[model samples]
Target: MSIDRRRFLCRGAALSAGLLLAPGWRAWAQSAPMLDPAARQARAVRYVEQASAAQDDPAYRAGRRCANCDFFSAGQRCSLFPEHRVSPDGWCMSWTSE
Candidate 1:
């Protein structure tokens, strides 16, 4: 299949406009987790023993973090642990940098 430049631009513009007009977009964007240390711990976030920790798992790395991981969203919430704010600098066993 082939796509024309004008058609692509129009579709992109429409999508952008749709997102901008969506009433829930603002609320959804603002609803990202706060990533509090205590709350995270209570939720079993394992912030101290993350993949970035010293002497952590073999797949762990020094600078890898949740903000850059595929499982994270909006630099706060995590797909693996929904409704909770995760540290952008935090890591976990499921961390996957992407």
Candidate 2:
């Protein structure tokens, strides 16, 4: 197997182990609601200012956004905030230009 795949599997195992050991994690997992990508993005957008232009903030350049930011991954989620899907046009305090 490729190193990347191995690493991914390892991380998944670690995460699962950690969650299994944490008290109330199973309950939380079972009870927590899941949101659609749009809803998740909407929730995430509350923390990040949605910007069309860099003028919205000093951190942003004319075209900077979650889709182009360093923290973004898989075209949908942000590494900086893993709990929800982030909008491609969203700009947050943690934004880092790629």
lDDT of 1 by residue, 1-98 (tens): 99999999999999999988676754775577555545645346445324445345565677777777898776367787666666677776676763
User: Where does candidate 1 have its weakest 10-residue lDDT segment?
Assistant: 45-54
lDDT of 2 by residue, 1-98 (tens): 45798899999999998987776754544343322334555445434546663465555566666777788766366676566555677665566762
Q: Any runs in candidate 1 off by more than 4 Å, and if so which? A: 1-17, 21-27, 35-45, 48-59
The true-versus-predicted C-alpha distance at residue 92 of model 1, in Å, is 0.9
Q: Determine the backbone clash count of candidate 2.
A: 0
Candidate of highest lDDT: 1
Q: What global local distance difference test value does model 1 have?
A: 0.66
Clashing residue pairs found in predicted model 1: none
Report the Cα RMSD per candidate: 5.0, 9.6
Candidate 2's C-alpha runs over 4 A off are 1-49
